[model samples]
Target: MTPSEYGFLKQFLKSRSGLVLSDEKQYLVESRLVPVTRRTGHKNLSALIADLGPRGSEDLKNTVVEAMTTNESFFFRDKTPFDHFRNTMLPNLLEGRRSQKRIRIWCAAASTGQEPYSLGMCLQEDRHKTAGFRFEILGTDISTEVLEKARTGVYSQFEVQRGLPIQMLLKYFTQQGELWQVSPELRAMVQWRKLNLLENFSHLGTYDIIYCRNVLIYFDQDTKRDVLQRLAKQIPEDGYLVLGAAETVVGLSDAFEPVPQHRGLYRPRKQGAAASPRLGSAFPTLKAMNS
Candidate 1:
């Protein structure tokens, strides 16, 4: 692809999906979109991109965006976030929301269901403690292809072996041919939807916890701040936000502040509040929560 075409693609992806491609990523773009060129019957990447110029169909644009969106995920991709969910987040929400007995979690950019499924498993294991509560997990992604796979709740042996424990896998999944499928009950716990973080999502309502891990690392600084601030609006003051270990709100937005001693955990900043609200009443220390 020419430098101009590559530049246009960079801007196009950023505008459509908040994906920032640096100058050195030209090869990456060619690698990912070449198949798209072939699928669209275009002779080359340049021809595929030319069609996107003045009269690009929304269908073509969406197809390109989905093709470029990464959907890499496995059960409990990183261990610490799930550890917090099982120990601190769950117990706290269980106590804080006792009157309502309902807790909603939004897994933004939740590619192929592993993270949400992991949470579902956590809730299932604590079923004895959460006798009267309702847990709603919404898993969303910009890619419909991944969402379809996630809805099936089926994983290949390699996918399952990535981060899933043997005991949990045996208890929650049944072998189907060479693949394993999540139990019907566990599959039902999560609702799947196609969502683009760059678009308005207020209609989805607020959540007690939002797991938006590993997605912001792809966004530019301005996009990161915009998305983070928007996310803050969907969380109540008592709610929490979990980000990827590599992402943080420190230099981005003050709408959230990191939970003391917790690396990837954050809580919404109450407007006009002088000091951060105390979580002692709701979110206990990890050690205390675990004990």
Candidate 2:
């Protein structure tokens, strides 16, 4: 791809999805969009971008965006977050919401459904603890293709093997010829939708917890602050926000403060305290969320 084409595509992706593609990612752009080029009958990435000019078809734009968006995920992708949820966060949330007896969780960038399903499995294990409480899990992603796959709750043997324990696999999934399908009960526990973090989230209502792990790394600093601020508005003061271990609100926004002893956990900052520069102190062994 020429520099002009690369620049145009980069700007387009940033405007649409807040994805920051640096010069080093040119090969990544070329590799990811090759299928799009062939499917759209374009000669190359340059041709494809040219055809998708100003006032491009919404379908075409969506195709480009989905192709570029990374959807790497697996069941319980990071064990610590789920463990923390089960041991610490859920109990506290349950006690706090005793009068309401209701809980809502939003799994943003919920690629192919693994993270939310993992949370669902944890909730299923402790159903007795939440006997009278109602729980809602909402999974949202930028790609409709992944959302459809998530809705189907079907996975290849390899996909199921990743981070899914054998006992839970036997209990929660049934063999559908070669692939495994998540149980109807687990599938029924979550809802999937297409949501861009750059857009308004007010329609999704407030949530007791939000799992937006592994997503912020793609955004630039300004976009990160903007997205975090928007997320802060949607979460109650007592609600929690979970990010990828590598991501932090340190220099991004003052809306959230690190949850002590939790590597990737955060809560809305108190009304009067100034934001801390020590946000990075919470997670000393930070690594990429997918790694």
Candidate 3:
């Protein structure tokens, strides 16, 4: 892609959805968007962008953008967070939110739906604890197509094995030909929707726990800070925010501090702790929302 072409597409993408494509990822732009050429009846990449330049239908524009949005995800991608959630966080959050008897979990970048469903499956391990609570595992992503797959709760064997444990797999998934489908019970736990973190998610309100993992690394520092601040507004003081282990709120935003229980997991500061965001509205304190 030429610099001029890159600039045009970058602006279009950022405007439609808060995605930033660095120059180094120029190849990614070409490789991903090539499919759009064939789909849109264009002979090549340049033609696809050129044809879409004027009077492109809303659906076509959306298809182009959705194609650009990365939807790579696997069962548990990173093992540590699930481990932390299961052994430490879930126990604490369940204990703290015990009286409320309800919990809301948001998986911010729930690409193709595996992460949130994985959380649901992990929670499935302890059914008794969740007996009285209202558990709603909300999964959101910027890409509508991926959101659709998440709602379906079906997966191929390769998809199921990515981060799933064998025992859990046997317990919660069923084999149908070559594909593995998650039990309806686990699938029913999550609700899917389209949400962009770059935009204000304040309307969604506070959540006991949020999983916005692994998606921040692609953003510029300013964008990271803004998104984190906005996320803080929808969370309460005791709320838990989990980011990718490689990612951090450390110089990005001062709203949260790493929890001692799980080194990478964080809790929001009270009204005047350190550089906590003034707009902080933590939904609830959760040692873990395992149930």
Top TM-score hit: 1
Q: Residue 118, candidate 2: how far off, in angstroms? A: 0.3
Residue-by-residue lDDT tens digits, candidate 1, 92-115: 778789899999999998899999
Q: What TM-score does model 1 achieve against the real structure?
A: 0.93
lDDT for each residue of candidate 2 in 89-190, tens digit (9 for 90 to 100): 787788789999999999998989999999998888778878999999999999999999999999999999999888888999999988999999999999
lDDT of 3 by residue, 1-291 (tens): 678888888888877777888878789889989878877787887777775676877888888889988888998767667776666556666767888887788999999998898788767766676677778889999888988888887788888878677777788888889988878988889988888787778888789889989888877788889888888887777678899878999988888887764656877866664533222122222223312
Backbone clash total, candidate 2? 0
lDDT for 203 (candidate 2): 85
Give the lDDT of residue 58 in candidate 1. Answer: 80
Compute the lDDT of residue 134 as modeled in candidate 3: 79
Please report how far candidate 2 places residue 155 from its true position, in Å.
Answer: 0.3
Better of 1 and 2 by TM-score: 1
